[model samples]
Structures are given as C-alpha cells and as structure tokens.
Target: MATAVLVLATVTTGLMAGLYLAFSVAVMPALARVDDTTFVRVMQRINDAIQNPLFGLVFVGALIAGGAAVWWHLDRGDVRWWVLAGAAGYAVTVVSTVAANIPLNNRLDRAGPVDRLADARAVRRDFERPWVRWHTLRTLVCVLAFGCLCVALSVA
Candidate 1:
C-alpha cells in the first residue's frame, strides 16, 4: 500500500511539474525574446490554454492521493521521512500553482496579444519576472519532494 501510494505521488508530482518546467525553464524566456510572431503568439495561447485544465487535475489529484499515500504509511512501522517530505511536496505544489500560476494566466488573458496589448511592458515587468521566480522555487521544491519520494521508495 505504501509503495503504491508513493508511486501515485511520484507520478502525479512529475506530471504536475511539467508546466512549470516548460514555462520558467523553457517557454517564457523564449517568448520574451523574438519579434512576437503570429506563430509565437498562437503557441503562447495554446500553451496557456492547455495548462490550466491539466493543472486543475494535477493539483487536486496529487494532494488527495499524496495525502492518502502518506496516511497509508503514517502509523505503519515502515514509515520514512521521505514519505512525509513527498506529501508536503504535493501540498506545496498545489499552493504554488493556485497562488502563483492561475493568477498569472488570468493576467496573460487580460493582456491579450503581445502586439496590441497596451502596457505590455508593465505586464512584462510587474508579472513575468516574479512569476518565473515563484515557479522556479516551486519547481525546486517539487524536485526535492520527488527526490525524497525516490529515497522512500529505495528504503521501502
């Protein structure tokens, strides 16, 4: 049961990390550059649209399953700190996505096309950098949590 829980947590957190990895690590900086072509703009729109619904699943699924996974081990003699760390990691992933990503998405929606969008620089200045910072932090935390989960798996 513990093994299964850890597996679920591992898979879900890994899935959950996908968007953050793409954005901060991959897309945004690329988007920030370039001449903001139609293809580039459309890609941003598609990427933005796709991520929200996915995150909606990841945030809820990771938490409920992760919590249950941790609970499955808590009173058992096989308990490990990695399990605790993993459970906490999923919890942080939920908080960071909810608190950071969703709002940024909404702002992007409001900002509209990079070409016509007024105060694009303001959005770029005020929102983008901070969002990246928070996402990087979230990614680091999730990675640590996933690492701990891996350790738990090794012991169990």
Candidate 2:
C-alpha cells in the first residue's frame, strides 16, 4: 500500500511538473505573440478549462499522495527524508500557486470579456507578465518536487 501510494505521488507530481513546464515553454510563449484581446480571451478560456475534474484530481491528488507517502515512510529512516523532501517541494508549489497564481487568475477572470473591456491591452498587461513569472516559478518548483519523488522511488 505504501509503495502504491508513493508511486501514485511520484507519477502525479511528474504530470503536474510536465503541465507547468508546457505552460512555461509553449503555452505562455504562444500567447505572448498574439494581440491583447486574443491573449486575454484565450487565457481566460484556458484558466477556466484548466479547472476541470481531471486536472483537479491530479493537482489535489499529488498533494494527498505525497502527504500519505511521507506519513507512511515515517518509521523508515532510510527513505523518510527523500519522501519528506518531495512532499515539502510539492507543498511549496501549492503555496506559491495559492499565494500568487490563483489571485492573478481570479483578477483576470474578474476583468471580464476582453472584447468588452475598455482597454484589453491593460487587462493583458496586468495579467500576462506576472502570470508568466509565477508560472515559471511553479514549473521549477514542481520539477524539483518530481525529481525528489523520483529519487525517493529509486531509493525505496
């Protein structure tokens, strides 16, 4: 059971890291080339779409499974540090997202339809650079978490 949970945590963290990496490398870069209206509209749609069940399951599941893996390995001194490090890394990702990205997303969502906004460029201006910066941080943190989990799996 502990092994299964650890595997699940590692896989989910890897997936989340990949997702963030894609955003950092591709999605944001592609969006950056478009006009402000298109950028805002597409970004709003993406932010909305990303909240669906599968994404939620992976996002929340990583945290739960990581926590579970940490708890399960508490008595195993050889592997506990790696599992704890993985969990800590993931926790940083979660905290950063909640503290930074989510608020930016919420602000962008509340900015309403890009076509209707008096200054679509202003809305995009407010959202794009900061969002990209936060996303980059998220990507790095998740990748670190994924690496830690991978190490834990190997050592376990």
Most TM-score-accurate candidate: 2
User: Best candidate per lDDT, number?
Assistant: 2
Question: What TM-score does each of the candidates earn?
Answer: 0.81, 0.97
- Candidate 1 lDDT over residue span 1-156, tens digit each: 667877887788777676557766667677667443443355457547776766668767878877887887786554556788887986887788789866876776676677876565565666567777877888888877777777777777
lDDT of candidate 2 over 12-129, digit per residue (tens):
9999999999888898889889999999999889989999999999999999999999999998777889899888899889998999999999999999888789999999888888
Displacement of the residue 70 alpha carbon in candidate 2, Å? 0.1
Clashing pairs in 2: none
CA lDDT, every prediction? 0.72, 0.91
Candidate 1: Cα lDDT at 91 = 86
Runs in model 2 deviating more than 4 A are none
